[model samples]
Target: MFRTENALILREVRFKESDRILTALTADAGKMTLAAHGALSKHSRIAAATQQLTYAELTLFEKNGRYTVREGVTKEGFPGLRQDLGKLALGSYFAECLEQYAGEDQPEPELMQLGLNSLYALSEGLGSCEKIKAAFELRLMTLEGYAPAEESCPVCGRGDIREPVFLPEEGQTVCRACRKAGRSLPLTENALAAMRHILHAPAKKLLAFRLTEEEQSLLSAVAESWLLHCSDRNFPTLAYYRNLKL
Candidate 1:
């Protein structure tokens, strides 16, 4: 059967000399591995759409349980990200995280939208790279049911947590007065506020908040630590992105 879907090309590998194997996150079907015949050829019509980090509308043929690309049209190539190595590395890291967390054969429209929005924001320079990275990390972890409780200090029941420290393992915050001896990342007021915004903001306004350089650094650390704790694994792409920053 033939069907068309909007998908983000998360990763691609060469399959033989001219064909390609694509790992795509579809709007309706979650993640899928697709065979794209001749997609790697210099003259292939679908080459642009099948490249990693490109969002495309693809015509796919499915037989039994496998899929093959029949046609593809690139919708957003994110040219701005391509022009900057740092942005591109960060975008690639996002793609890798999506591949790891997104479920196959499940409808994940929210996740799909988050991926598209993040890429669009990065491509358009709507926010700083660090801001975007922190937002995406926290939001994606929330979507996957690992959201940290930032509403208040879990220990004191204080709605306003002054001088908060984030506990990655506990997935919540505690006021400095209530913090116990454990692994924790201290959060500046702005960093804590940014985390709340990222966790609760609407998709369109997820990246609307701003932060000072120090605050951004703190937020990024909290976000990454939370994600790494919840996911329980490291991503090579993430390491590469960090290396690029350094």
Candidate 2:
């Protein structure tokens, strides 16, 4: 049977000489692998749409629980994301995060929207890369149902978080009165505000906030820590993104 879906190519691997295999996150089907015949060869229709970071509409032939691309139409290749090493690395990081969190055949529309919106922000140069990454990380977690408690300290119920402390593994914010020694990362008020904005803002306004360098650093730390603790795996793409000279 033939099944068509709108998807983002999260990963692509060369297969044999001219064929390629793609790991794609579909808007309706979650994540799945699609084989592109002759994608490496000249004059192949599916070639452009099969590249990593390309978002496309794919028509696939499925049998025995596997999918092969019959045709593909490119929607957004996010060209601007490739213009700079930093943006490219960050885009890869976002793709890797989606690959980890999205499941096969388990439709996650919100997550798909989050990924597409983030790529759009990056591709359009709408904000600082650090701000975009921080927003994406926090919002991705929130969409996955692991959002940090930002209204008050989970342990002490303290509403005043002038100096907020975030516990990554627990997915909670802690007040000074409830902080366990060595158990939290210090979050500046701006960092706290950034996270709140990411989780609560309108879809069009999620990346509307700005951050100072110091706040960006703190938010990056907390976001990365929470992602690592929740994912419990090393993301090489993220590591590479971090090591690049920004």
Give the whole-model CA lDDT for all candidates, comma-separated: 0.92, 0.88
- Model 2, position 123, has a per-residue lDDT of 91
Model 1: runs farther than 4 Å from truth? none
Per-residue lDDT of 227 in model 1: 89
Q: Write the per-residue lDDT of candidate 1 for residues 3-58, one digit (tens) a residue.
A: 99899999999989999899999879999999999998888999999999999999
TM-score list, all predictions: 0.98, 0.95
Report the CA-based lDDT of candidate 1 relative to the real structure: 0.92
The Cα error of candidate 1 at residue 91, in Å, is 0.7
lDDT of 2 by residue, 1-246 (tens): 998899999999999999998989997889998889899999998989899999998999999998999899999999998898899999999999999999887887887888999998999999888888888988898888888789987776677775898887688888766788666888887778888988899878998777888888888889889888888899999889879954
How many clashes show up per model?
A: 0, 0
- Model 2 residue 60 distance off true place after TM-score fit, in angstroms: 1.1
**Stretches > 4 Å off in candidate 2:** none
